[model samples]
Target: MTNMSAAAAGPNATYNFKVVLLGEGCVGKTSLLLRYIEDKFNDKHLTTLQATFLNKKININGKRINLAIWDTAGQEKFHALGPIYYRNSNGAILVYDITDEDSFGKVKNWVKELRKMLGSEIVLIIAGNKIDLEHERTVPLEEAESYANMVGAKHFYTSAKLNQGVEELFLELTQEMVERFEQNSQTDLNRTQRVLVVDDEAPVQSSCCTGSKTN
Candidate 1:
């Protein structure tokens, strides 16, 4: 956990986290993000460029959480740029088209890369998107859930077209992030207290050493 991504605690942001969305092209990553960020969706296929950045503020448990979200281009040619976007990200959402098995396969590769770069401390969410097309689904729900469990991620079935499960997914993610932030904050406080205790005892130890020298 030494290299864990730290949530930003700033004047304007009570708790700030960077979140990255990863998946193969046409997996509804952008759609899911748009639905979450703006509650809006387009039926037309939207291709991101290098990436798109957005800042969202939400209040969870009476504390404001600022989310820095980055939606990256999912095209094969832009795959190399993934690291640049996901580096130091506190959370990642791996979106897969439930109708496309290959999209789910690509999500696995993305998951491997994210864990390699960000490690286990980074919150991971696996989204089986396009559930509105359930009739066309090729990715089994059990399989996705099992894989998510194996990797310590939460799995969700989402449909941006129907605006279903989008809000719930973000709410779950926000709560998890808030819990992590509180835990991290407590750890830091404990570490600081330990250091202060050591510092206060330093002079006493030095005085005892001086007395020993005099004797």
Candidate 2:
């Protein structure tokens, strides 16, 4: 177990993490990213460039993770740039507009492309946005959740406009990433203490000698 008192007394260090946002055009990918980055909502329908990059820092489990958030352009024309952003990303957030049925329909394609481009080790999350406009919602939560489950991704319904579940989703992802890091760290730590026997005796004893053993 990590010592809570030591963590509180130690100097905080920033651990770099990469995260990307993906979805079809007009799926509120930019909106959610902007809301998370700037804490301001803009309903403007501006097209994102090849990519939108943002830097953010989050504290998870008493450790700081400096996130390099890549918000990819959702236009079909910019599809060529998708691989560049997805490559080496620690996690991905796949957004779909709840009100736009077409956008919702493209979720599977986006997830497939992410798996193809980023590999299966990356953390994947499906975000259903525009939930504030319930009357305009075309994608049901159950269906979205079902698809997310099929892809083995976390599912979340968020309304960037209403500021609902946006922070919680980021926090959840941060915790997930941190938990994964901690698990890997522990695995590495466990691997470091290999038992080896060293004998200063003759060549005959060297062969039979057992190295240092762990406590």
Candidate 3:
């Protein structure tokens, strides 16, 4: 994470993170991305072909962060290409339609694939989309929450059509990514400092013997 002061030095230092949206077709993955990026939604179904990319810039605690979001194609044919788009993603949004139980099951499969390829380090959020249709929902919120906890991911209900819980979801994920990056950076810095101290002490120990020999 870039320091808030870094933004004052010149232009706001921008931190870029790649985030991918994954789920089955018609699960509102595209709608969620569209609502977040463009603040608009359509009733007609728009199936993603290969993948769609969108960039959103936000400020987190005075630091600039850019989320490069990828809305992936969820059809079976495009399944193999999912790993390609999310190869080095910093985070992921695993979406599912709350009204469709099958979609929720597919979310699990997507989570498994992500874990297998990216490991547990990638920040994950399980989005139960279509919350507007809660009256017809087949998957219970508790079930989704339990699965999210089991997989070490956060879960939230979202309704892109109504623009509810969309912004907060992305903001929370971005914050998590920033925190993770900062923690990893601090760990690396501590390790480097320890190595430098060891290297400096070696020369001091070696020079002490040389001074004794001269005496």
Best candidate per lDDT, number? 3
TM-score of each: 0.86, 0.80, 0.86
* CA displacement after TM-score superposition, residue 213 of candidate 3 (Å): 26
- lDDT tens per residue, model 3, 98-153: 98899899999989988888787789999999989989999988999999999999
Residues 1-215 of candidate 2 have per-residue lDDT tens digits of 11111122245855677888988988788888888888988878857888978999777666877888888889888988888777777788888888888887777887887787666657788898888888988887788899888888999999988888898888887777666655656665566543222343345544554686868
Score residue 51 of candidate 3 by CA lDDT. 96
- Candidate 1 matches the true fold with a TM-score of 0.86
| Residue 158 lDDT, candidate 2, scale 0-100 | 93
Candidate 2 deviates by what RMSD? 7.9
Candidates by lDDT, descending order: 3, 1, 2
> In order, what lDDT does every prediction score?
0.85, 0.78, 0.87
The global Cα lDDT (0 to 1) of model 3 is: 0.87
Query: How many clashing residue pairs are found in candidate 2?
Result: 4
